[model samples]
Target: MTETPSREHRPEPLWAQAAELISEQITRDGLTPGSRLPTERDLCARFGISRVTLRKALGHLLDRGLVTSSHGRGWFVATPSTVREWPNDLESFTTTARRKGLVARSEVLEQLVRPATLDEADALAVPAGTPLLVLERVRFLGDVRMALDHAVLPAALAPGLADVDFTAASLFEELTARGVVLDRSETAIESRIAGEALAAKLHLSAGEPILLLDQTIYDADNRPILLSTVEYSGDRYRLRTTFRPR
Candidate 1:
């Protein structure tokens, strides 16, 4: 006798099935942004799934940036915002920004080879006075100008990058296309007033508050690939995180 495949052999989870159904509904109904979703009980009954399974599916939508839940209210479809959050296994800035429905645009202000300053050498873990490739850019979210990113790459690595259009794409993304393996990143964030040049790029008045992020992206072998500093305008940006104690 031939035996049927076990339930464990199913290709997708209950939540995944539920997520697809809800996703299809959203698409079919042409639900505009900020539209409220159905109740959990309604969803469970509609999909013929258990409450537990239905919730699992809702979780998938939340992870996909498609929906959000509230305490008093139920789930609602998300509207695009300038809020930036890091994704799990985030590999590129352009990819991350685009996922949030923001157009990732940049303008290269400076691209040249220069000797690393004492601080730059310390941050990059290279010899003092080592030559480094520097690319300065202003990053925009949609039509709103957001941040000025100053990126420094080691001279010991790809020296041919000076000719690339940094404004057209991200350096990290371009490096990956060249078969470079970037494993992880170290990021530090703080807030400060914008300098004169930064103010002009972000169209900010003097002494305005700004969020400053310093990021170091490393390769698979824990070698530092790029050092970057990003400055964010005050009114147009915010950062979110979920923390767990060690």
Candidate 2:
């Protein structure tokens, strides 16, 4: 009987070969993320291939998450978003954005001090009616809107928080300056559909799938200090972790 060939033994297709050449060119040309690639006609001529073959090559890159397509605008290099936390690393949004060579930004939506409700008090292990600070922001990576962040904490723990402008600031850094360094976080993730108002803010259509990350961050004393919630576009975020078997 004739033997079937394994995937590893198969010859690379022309489209895949084109993809490799294009990937190398992206680096050689110094096209950073959000930069548009050369037009399809130019790529076709340079690769000596038909438009169909060039499209196939581009499609490969799209599947690899290396590029994104804008309607009527062609393909652009894409920077992956960081909505998922690194296991055991209490990294902040600005930290992750810097690591990815992107510009991080925030638009403050709401910030206020209010008395803690029973549920909020229970979550932070504080007594009811305790004064708490609440903040809501739209977070961005590069020029793309990435996630919406909302956080709550005891007002006394972070003084002058209301006076700080969050648009160009990092809450983690600000908290550290106030002597409230976060030590760890207990996180949970869930999937949900984006409703009308939420969709408008994120530039997504209603009913789009979104990822919700709910977490409570603690200090070195093991006391929960911040209750945070983030909503991420489904295609833009991924949570990763590792478990060591005992």
Instruction: Look at candidate 2 and give me any clashing residue pairs.
Output: none
Clashing pairs in model 1?
15-57
Best by the lDDT measure: 2
In angstroms, the error of model 2 at 7 is 23
Q: Compared with the true structure, what per-residue lDDT tens digits does model 1 show for residues 54-140?
A: 778788887777776654467776544434455555456688777776668888899999899998888878998899999888886
TM-score for each of the candidates:
0.63, 0.74
- Each prediction's Cα lDDT score? 0.74, 0.82
Write down the lDDT that model 2 would get. 0.82
lDDT of 2 by residue, 127-195 (tens): 999999999999887567778899999999989998899997989999998999799999988999988
User: lDDT, candidate 1, residue 175?
Assistant: 78
RMSD of every prediction? 12.6, 7.2
